[model samples]
Target: MALIEYRFDNLRHDRIGSRGIDLQSLDRRSMEQAIAELRALASQKDITFPRLPEAPVEPIIARAAADRKDFSDLLVIGIGGSSLGARALLSSCTPGNPGCRVHVLENVDAHEFERIWSGLDPERTCVNVISKSGGTVETMANFLTVRQRLLDRFGVQGVRDRVRVTTDPESGILRAFAQEEGLVTLDVPPGVGGRFSVLSAVGLYPLAMAGLDVEALLAGAAAARDAALAPEAESNPAICFAAHQVALHDAGTRGLVFMPYATRLFDTALWFVQLWAESLGKVRRHADGHTENVGPTPIAALGANDQHSQLQLFMEGPADKCVLLLDVEERRDLRVPAVPAVLAGLQHLEGQSLDDIRAAELRGVRAALTEAGRPNATLSLKDTGARSMGALLMFLQCATGLAGSLLGVSSYDQPGVELAKRFAHGLLGHSDHAHLRAAADRAGQGKALTSVH
Candidate 1:
């Protein structure tokens, strides 16, 4: 059986009426061509992310074990791809585990820094500064602030002992600084971008410190990778999913709502948002030199809870969304108490397992969406274990790469985000970006049509 069970029945014309995808009418040749491109890319040395699951775990395990022996807490300093993958992995796998605790500082909020800093013992906390380029303003700011705190608490040598750096192996500011300071360092792999570096030292190191089975995580990812490389598109989940998404997007589905019913998997959905939005959303220049803006807007949502919060809009407000519902076959659950005489409306929930009730909610929502002529699909997992989470992450990443191919855009680059960063640097008075800063100021001088005080 597949690690994830993908059901597209509700996304079919027969199930969801006029708005659903017609399987027979899908452009199979284009999808097959995209899959072929993905296959070719996977074999290239420049694209290393697809091969990350097969990387050796011994070094990461050894380093993590050593760090865990000395530190009681880990303060991670990074943002975006540098931190999201680790955060998702730790959140999903290490909850309630009696292991070294992890505290991540991804934002520049002073209050958040203070809260995390005040809770740690500098002596027992190890600071991990991650940046593939080592030039991220937010990450550098947090790293500097935290580094000073460690220096204040402990001497220079002590700071060296407690701090680590993860960035490009040979270049970048962080790499140079680590070499000069003699601090422990790990590489983020040469060709792997930040978003796709999770299965590398970027994510594995922290997960290992958190007492998660990093090997098992890779094992699950490897299984998914093999399935992704299958020649038959029908048996390949990633290709099939990419084809479905491309077909739906072409059919006027502008929003992709990723709703996973499990709370542990919520961050996974958020991770998917960045992966999908950044990778596929692009302005592409065709062979004729004509450019066009493309890609779907990805919305991250939690289930059962969002049923009350966002379901109303998804059900009745918009006809431009295609929902991907994630359901986990939970291994542990609780049963509701017997019905009470005073509460009659709630009687049906009594004596039912919480998951059983959740299953009903999932089913009801799927039915309601279908009845209303909305397209949706379910990706069910066996459980939310380390293996399952690993498989899910890899599967989504592969699907995203294939989707980028279908859209005729480069999946790994984020030129829009880079442009914004440049503007921010200019606005912040960076010597190199002074021209940009002046332009930004000029743009800001324009008056608003209306305002309220």
Candidate 2:
């Protein structure tokens, strides 16, 4: 595959000036060293990635694409990684192709559920309930609500066939329920986490249902894995990225934002956010066991959309943020001018093609962000397809792990999220009003909340 070259040198000075960081003399040598170490680790971990079966999954994917079932809609019930990865893949791949609608329900917002329920025909919709643990409160709740809706609309038989599950093997409430209820099932690998599961069945199944090329996607990921596992700093994209980002963080840049130019990539940014945050946000302890808070804060923004909204804050706000700009190199649909005579007078503007206009706009945005002193990096995709997307996802995941290692954090575990889960369970399982009252009191004290009392 041809490597997408970056014009980093052109933007480097402007980025440094904007962020007030002199990265000119930053040790690129250390980055090279870190890359070497990470490459070795990646090579050693064979168990990290298992070969996906070629036969059964391929047939299922084909069948799903062919059998448009009565379901005009699909509601994916999952939280965090389970939801974000698949949502990102689906959104980016299906721009303007509105054969069927895909909605993701990850939160317990009643209003959102109500809206979805009102719009969807339960008989005509398939609900993909995804939970690695099978007992995630938010996911299970959404599943139950949707299941009930199905029961009400299409009766028992419809519910049995329409509801599908993606989860671990022979464990969790979801797995058991899927078996007992005889719903269609997909196995989520035990070793994979939700954020790191885009190339797995968790993401592939949905993308397949949406008529995406899962084979191309997996091939892309495999290619990326090869590139990331290579030792050379100049050759290994993931390592180079990791080194550069870690060096930036050490230089006092703490805020990281992913800004994708296309609207489809907005959800991709969210998926990246979870992967970066869950991996890097940690308190590193010294040899003496003393710990310190040190991690990059991750944020996501849509390109032209946020260019109008949040670009102001990014440009004028604190000078501690690093931005990653994702640019798609090819667009399938191009809007052309009906006639060259539409815009006359201005010599430069007259007879300008739509593609020319779009190019100019994108260039202008990059130039503006660079001039504003934002340290921005760009990732260009040759085209938006399953292969390129899969490559991108795998590349980001490897880069994230390397970046975390450089920052001295365990990039695999998420202990903080477990705390929230525990607290939520306590509140839900117990009949004690004290805990609820305490939460309410805290909420009331916060200025953001509207208090009844």
Candidate 3:
């Protein structure tokens, strides 16, 4: 199994000066307690993600293989947690010659959806509709639109052969539709929510269809799960990371910049943004009936690229942010040719591989941030393989859960998101959500408005 290396030296005051975190002053007891709580949570039957790696994958693999044999393209329809995890996996693992072209219909934008839909050959396309609740508007809208197109082109039997659905096994409108249509289906596991469903059929099915190694991916996640369960906080990378983040948050750090050096892992950073923001950002109600808004803002950035774009603000902006740098030690490489004599000033880069320059840039940024007294840390992978990506994703998920515990928030629920969804449903004229629509209209009645032409 490939393991990720967690380095926190740059986050320490001794290394990054006064503005950095001081290990001696950290709340060790609170962190330990949080980890203990997370351990218990993991052992609970209702928290199913930690056990996802152990679920049987034979059925998923068989289905994917069949899809690969029959289809030239696979369209994954879903949004947010439903689509982000699969995007992260495919972006990072399905490079080179993918077995089938995988396109994702994650948004409800008509133009984007039309582009993807129009490009696909209906006869050779497989549609995978994924929604744990079977009720997400964006996901359902896109899937319904595509289903209509498939029905027009292939008829009912053809639609059944081409469509696959992953939803709640025991309930959900999508499940009922699948049964009514006799479409092949997979379960999203009883307790595994969308954000935590990657290791389950949600991710494995698509990955298998792409001819990637699902077993290796699960192995890496399992390894990460074991490491996160270590008895000592220092021995568990996830706990240690969560503890540092909590300490930083206590010190008024509000923004977390998740910058990954590799372009492929940029999607992984976005996936982390959702996991961290949705899982941690919450209104915590105390025993006294008072509520406080909690959780840090997660900023996703691509390194080397963001170094040119957002690095300036980070270096000199408010001391309200901490940087988490992601490094992939090995990558596909290209050597820079020797600089021409006329361009002698740029000779320093001559004969250096692109990866070498990227390493230098990462190191220089770390040093510069340290000199500026801005706290930062790095999480590194030996290579951008399936195992490494799995470990990276699991580590972030574990850290998010632990950090939520430390912050005294419910990690599994997103009440704020649901409130927004209710408003959207109301706006769309859903009878049950009419009250939410009225509330939204009332709130918007006298708000100032601005327009630009």
Q: What is the model-wide C-alpha lDDT for candidate 1?
A: 0.87
Tens-digit lDDT string for candidate 3 (316-380): 98988899998888855698997988986899888889998898889989889888989899988
**Which residue runs does candidate 3 get wrong by more than 4 Å?**
95-98, 442-447, 450-453
Weakest ten-residue segment in model 1 by summed lDDT: 91-100
What TM-score, computed on C-alpha atoms, does each candidate reach? 0.97, 0.85, 0.96
What global local distance difference test value does model 2 have? 0.73
Poorest lDDT segment (10 consecutive residues) of candidate 3: 92-101
In candidate 2, which residue ranges exceed 4 Å CA deviation? 1-7, 10-56, 59-71, 94-100, 153-157, 331-347, 353-355, 430-453
Q: Which lDDT tens digits does candidate 1 get at residues 12-56?
A: 988788788888877777777877876786788654888888767
lDDT of 2 by residue, 1-453 (tens): 343433354235544563444446555666566666556554443324323322236645654665355567777788888889888888777432334577888899999989877887776677888998886889898889888877887887888878878898668888888888888888776656677776766777677667677788778777777787666667678877776677777778888888887778888899988998888888887889998887888899877777788888877888778777778777444445344555574556545655456556667767776877777777888766877887788888888877876777878788878756655665676454336546644654756756587
Total backbone clashes of model 3? 0
**Candidate topping lDDT:** 1
Comparing 1 and 2 on lDDT, the stronger one: 1
Go through the candidates in order and give the clash count of each: 0, 2, 0
Order the candidates by TM-score, highest first: 1, 3, 2
